[model samples]
Target: MMVDEHENHTIDTVISLLDILIIIQIEDDPIIGIVLVALLKTVTKDRLIRILLILLVITLGEVSEIKS
Candidate 1:
């Protein structure tokens, strides 16, 4: 049981790390952003996707301005 819990915690950490990577990629480069979205689609759950979508929506405007 403890091992199972630890494994779950590890997975959550990885997902969170991936989320951060995706956000950073979106800000830094469009090509990497696409790749990270593909990676996120393969590894993450629907809930994480929805959360990321919301975050992406919120950050898109800000990131666009930064690019200009």
Candidate 2:
């Protein structure tokens, strides 16, 4: 669960970008799309997948707790 400084920064950046893009038309903004694509490329395919998997696990855990 320990994410290093780089990973932590990346996560924060991704979240911030998502917040911005969600508030508007993401497809309409080419700048945001370019920025997001750049960020995703830097995060790499494996790391992106890892982050999504971690989120999935956390979501499932919360769901199970709610069911209990």
Best by lDDT: 1
lDDT, residue 43, candidate 1: 66
Task: Give lDDT tens digits, candidate 1, residues 10-59.
Answer: 86676566566565656657686666666656765665564566367447
TM-score for candidate 2, please give it: 0.37
lDDT of 2 at 21: 46
RMSD for each of the candidates: 9.4, 12.6
lDDT of 1: 0.65
Worst 10 residues of 1 by lDDT: 49-58
- In the predicted model 1, the residue pairs found to clash are none
List, residue by residue over 22-60, the lDDT tens digit for candidate 2: 334344566864565466556655656645644554465
> For each candidate, what TM-score against the reference?
0.43, 0.37
